[model samples]
Target: MRNLRLTLAWAAALLVAVSPLVNAQTTSEKNLKSDKKAAMSKETLPRPKVIIFDVNETLLDLAPLKSSVGKALNGREDLLPLWFSTMVHYSLVETLSDDYHSFGEIGTAALMMVAETQGIELSYDDAKTAIVTPLRSLPPHADVIEALKALKADGYKIVSLTNSSSVGVETQFKNAGLTEFFEKRYSVDSVKKFKPHPETYKMALADLGVKPEEALMVAAHAWDIAGADNVGLQTAFVARPGKTLYPNADKPDYVVNDLSELVKHLAATKTAQADTESDKTLAEQLAAQAAKSAKRFPESVRKVYAEGIETVRATQIEESAKQVGDAAIDAELTNWNGETVKLSELWSEGPVVLMWYRGGWCPYCNIQLRAMQQNLDKIENAGARLVVLTPELPEKAKETAATNNLDIVALHDNGSAVARKYGILFKLPAAIVPSYRDKLKLPEYNGNDAMELPLSATYVIDKSGTITYAFLDADYKKRAEPADVIEAVKAAAK
Candidate 1:
């Protein structure tokens, strides 16, 4: 009994000694969470592949529609919003009940219901005319066109996904001059559903061939944002006049006052980390490799290599080659699997990190390819594709891919044809060409007798085919660091 009492006393003493530290840790975590929640209010969302816009009231102004509805409701313009709400409610009712009605018909019914609730006489034809006519001819919101133009120029896929019917949205867009802005316009009428229905959003994602996370639903209605959020899509809430967020719904990724402000946030280079730190750059490693390899070669051969590099530099090929801000040409090249891959097609899905390798025989090229493979995940996570081009035959490209175990795209730039277009193709040193032909078997590998090869260049091209980053060098040993390319991809996304 005495021993038990002593052990209990020890346990109590230990708890007392550690209580303060445990309390401090808990308090710190709570404060950190509090700070994070506060910061979220000012945070902007990441860029999405497709921006799905809600048409009614979100892009189009409802003031004219309101006046028309008010005239039908005995000059009670305040009842216009109520009629719209009733219309939306009935849409949900029809969807859940497995019944379908055109949005115009529902709107007409809703307006009649509102008129009856207010003890006013209304006819179906008059209500239909009031709702459909004004809704079709409604003017676009003031901030709509310029913001849409900016996004379209940036190569963002702009889609209009709305509760309005297909014919209704078509008429509306044509009348408002918005048909030119949208890549596609989808309507709930196709699925016979309402805005908050999950299937409506799913149908769009399916048709567009995009994952839910790749799309952002922008709307003025809190309920719509809630539906999109629940469906695993990022959402933006445009707090237009008289529209407020739902208190119980999850907060949207963005809460902007207008589309113009949303564009500004999307354009900010928030993810571009130019100073992203690393232990060593690929260029530095290449320098180290060059120095080490020099010991293996004779002094005469080393002198020849130096002259070749200097000679190429004198040509100023870097100035003539495609650089940043240039439009990337759609070079249709075949991959190791004999699949035709076009640069424009690749850029359509995401930003591309296009790299040129001399051949698998070069030690420096192998080193750089391995480094790029290691950083492949980082590049892809930033929403970019890594495409490695080599002036080797399709079978030789396969060998290189197998040798390095490279799982990403490896393409054959047959005959250095694509390289010539990029202005990076150059003749080899006359002294070394004979030895390279015999020793490296360059002619057999590339299926050409021309002693020409492209520079070890790298470029990052955005979805619009605009080159956002380029690395050109005469020295074959040097390469663009993968970390910098990843940063460039992130910047290109903005």
Candidate 2:
């Protein structure tokens, strides 16, 4: 009996010690399974041929609309988030109830709800006008246009699929100057459902004549990504500020902070698929050529070049200047003949190519001017005028034009005032000032004591006053190539 008791005691002790180990093993197995599931969930997918972009906050910026709403609400912009969330919620509610409401109407209703909750009086008509009008004129988010152009250049059929009404999307695209980027604009109203609904995504796929797996949906909203992923479409989630992917939804195939990163991802896939070494973008080719040319310069000259390149790299002029969608600022200046000319008058003829040059002294400027002169025929043929602006006085400007044998109109910006307005004027760096003052005599040529010069930036302005192409760099040697300028003009004319 004592042996039996000893054995039982031992068994009981063993059980106590091993119980925790068993529990730990079970927990470990569960964790392993969970991790494996997550890994599978995030498995990368193949690229898609067609890319569908989401409008409203995805591509178009809504901050201005928020401001307008805030003005209507006694300067309470904090209420915008609640209003937008409420609108999205009711949009889904309407979709689930087999009902249909235009996004604009939903926005108005949401605004009204917010006003009521805040105990503020807001008329329905005022709400509608405030919300809907801004919606129609919203500008695209930064990095949207360039990314879309990159994707399109890579042969992807880009389209916009939104919950907005057809007319609403049309006006939005038109006002945003994004109509040309999209091959087609789709509205969820056609399917009588809002996004995050499988039907809405499926409808877009059907309309594009693409299978769900063959198309990718790019959106700033997690719900949009979730809905597209649920319907078997590839998804790219653009995590705009304050946007997050839904934890419960399937992981998107790609996640980026903005459209520019998405474009880089897609462009890499395209570059991988190219069969030959010659299939490269113009920008890439130019960069390669510039690198090759840099090797030939003497060390002193190369140092200047390096400094210029570094300065340009440091200054994000391209981002700060009037970009593709911005209206070109009208400026008044005198032509080389001392006749006052306005930029608006130049645009009245056709598309205008506005260029800035340093002065008659800079070899780089002369090279660029002569190069542009060679392409003047092509520019004029494309229904565009090539107008050059220089800080040089009228006689010096005339000298530069005659020296290059250029027939293009040369304007004299006497005080660099017009250049400053375009965000292209900068004071000469201290290192370069001695050369300009002693060797170049820039003050005499430009007739300016300020020692300021405009960056040799070029812009292609369309007839609608929108700047379609802008090449602004602090490095004067990196002026826009004539061929690229011609291509830009052609695009503007189109």
Candidate 3:
């Protein structure tokens, strides 16, 4: 009886000693859960120093390629999605099997697989030409350019991480008019792994000199976001149409319907974090500059400029150029002296520098004309003849040449037939037509009832009638630098 009582006393002592320790563990766990909840609900995340973008679907619109693929499949448009899914599936298979194949190869294989399933015969060459060729020339999403510009202005270093081969991405960006916005182009080719592979994201981080936490991966695919999240990087999911997040994957730090929405969210977050006084001062400065510029030009002229900027941004003018190294069309044009000259005839003598200008009324054109005149001697020394093409009438061309003292031939492209041949002619927007006709008397200068203009472009054509170099931009104010033009001429001469 004595021993039993001692044992009971010891048991009671042990319970008293363990009670506070158990309470402390429970309290600690509760605190951890509270902290996690706070993080999940946090309104602001630490801003990323670098933003890595996915190239396909996220930036470039692949919808146009769907039509080409569908046509190849006997107009079965429904097969496009299946083909794309198979391509992605096989790419992952390649990664998992420790093998490597170009994205183009995998895509072609996927096309063949889909064709076999449908009992359709498809040649590898035909499939690649029809489907993969279009991938190089996909157009950008409508909001991509503006959103990228905003992010750049807000001081974010943007880079592209794509599964495409290096040459493929280069051509893609060049054709999509998106090459200028990205700081660098990264391809999974270097690492031999497709995306969702940790190495692919790690390669981007290492190349960009950014820590995982300091970078944000922006993608349209939920798998991409989950991959980035797994590696400790922040993520923004752009929920493109017909896309959904992976049900089992961790949620991204931010989610938006599109890139434009993401830009707005980032802008708001930035404003919330920035110093109020500095932001106010910067805003006032911008407003003042805008007011000054608005007052400097007449209302009609301002409207024309505004409309021009908008139109050019919305149009795919950059890709309209005839591909480089193609034969230049043998276009007959009337010079200022009423003499007809064929482009081939000029090329037979030596290399030719062909330039397109708006008219004498345009200050930008005049600047470009004078700049070319200054480089005329150098052009001749490099064994090239300089010829300027204008849609203006012969009389207007003569006046422009005489006014600028330009000795180079100024050809009158009467109805912009030569420009049309070069695939650079575009009708003036309705919004700017009235200002051009009534305010600037454009019809009087061009001798035409219709308002049409060629894009401001310059080309260096070799003796073989091949276009060796081209500088084409829709913005009237941007012209090819004289030095670059001279260098191109010298290279063409060689």
Candidate 4:
């Protein structure tokens, strides 16, 4: 009964719409509690791979349901706030007492308790009909659909976690036209536990194979944010009508008045991050990478690689390689799946960024490949495609693709024939031959004992089959940067 008084106090505050959760001004302002944290609040939110949303007032408009619940309380429409708070409070009580009941059943029980307290004679059956009927047919708010579509288009995995029963949310989404947006929907019935219990969130994380830190929980209820924040997931608070953060809980990563605001914040943060990445030039990136990798290799191996780089520099091999204004070579090769690929046909759509590397065994190649892949989207957005040429066997090329988690189009240039056509092919240094063939198993990877490689080269060719840009480097450590290639691609596009 004591706890019930506290619940009613919160309900009264919510009914008035005059204060933050529990009337503490804000759960956020009080939770700061220190100067450093308040300052750190200015930091932009880190991007999340997946977003888990709470369905009730966060996604749906609960205002329409008040009429039905009000009808049960003898026309006392305002008591709807008290009934909701009571239902949530009792759900917590049910969990703490080691008992289990579906959320709908608990809602009915809460409605009965509210009526009994009001001195109104309401039967259990009447309470159930009032709460359960309107709950399932609630309409979604105005700001929901567009924000959900924006999130999906940006490649975020969206799912719902609701205290409502499975059939309950399904009917609501179906009625509200929200079923098409979510990849999945979860109900507390799956774990037989209500939310704010920690286990409910954990159940979803485990099922999705997502780490807590990799997910963001978005909810209108402050208690829902509290639960997710304590468990190490990123949180976003949606300040819907009558929804506020709990005064004692940690501040959410984002606090927005609607789902549209949430999407705007995310877009701004991503643009800021991209700007930060753009500030560093690719040459500076490679030099930093070379310095870091230099420490990982032994003196003997490093000496051989250094000598090989110097030898190529002395020979001036890049001067004879493919250059801007040259007619692009048309070479037929097999992709990782053993499908034929022609450079001429590939660039017919727009432009193609063709890069050739020795094989996956070369650390330099691996580093360069990863760097380019990180900017693959940017390249494509510039109206170009990227194709990687490697002398490794198709099977080994497929293995490399999987290992690096790269989705770039990779083709196997079987005997370095394409490299020779580009005039960038070269024989492996004698000093590195033994280790390259025996220890690194280069022969098996390429299905040959030719002991050869290519001067790391990249070319941007226009749709007319003319090489618009070329990057040829004799010093293996000095590969072309993706940033430079993007610029060249932009140039070629004109």
* Top TM-score hit: 4
TM-score of each: 0.53, 0.48, 0.48, 0.58
Q: Stretches of candidate 4 above 4 Å error?
A: 1-46, 280-494
State, as a TM-score between 0 and 1, how close model 1 is to the true structure: 0.53
Instruction: List the candidate numbers ranked by lDDT, top first.
Output: 1, 4, 3, 2
The local lDDT score (0 to 100) that residue 401 gets in candidate 1 is: 60
Compose the digit string of candidate 2's lDDT tens values, residues 219-278: 999988877776667789999998998998667878999999998886565444332212
| CA displacement after TM-score superposition, residue 370 of candidate 3 (Å) | 51
The per-candidate count of clashes, in order, stands at 0, 0, 0, 1
Q: Return the clash pairs for model 3, or none.
A: none
- List per-prediction Cα lDDT, in the order shown: 0.81, 0.77, 0.78, 0.80
Better of 1 and 2 by TM-score: 1
For residues 1-494, write the lDDT of model 3, one tens digit per residue.
Answer: 35534644654565567558645644533343334324434334445667899988889888888988887787887898899888887787677557899999999988877877787888999889878878989999998999999988876778999889999999999998889899999999999999887789989887765556558899998878877776667789998887889988767877998888998887776555333213333224234334534543557778777788668656776786675787888888888677888989999888999999999767567657766776678888989999899998887787666544467668888789889889888888887888788756889888878788898888999999999999887776677777788899899888
Local distance difference test, candidate 3: 0.78
Q: Mind giving the per-residue lDDT tens digits that candidate 1 earns over 1-494?
A: 35535644654566567658645644533343333334333333334668999999899999999999999999999998788887887786676557899988989988987887787888999999888889999999999999999988866779999988888899999999999999899999789888787788989987865556557899999989977876667788999999999998667878999999988776662232111212457776567557645644568988888899988888999899999999997889888777898889889888999999998667688668867877888999999999989998887777666545467668889888888999999999888787678767788778889999999999999999999999999989888989899999999987
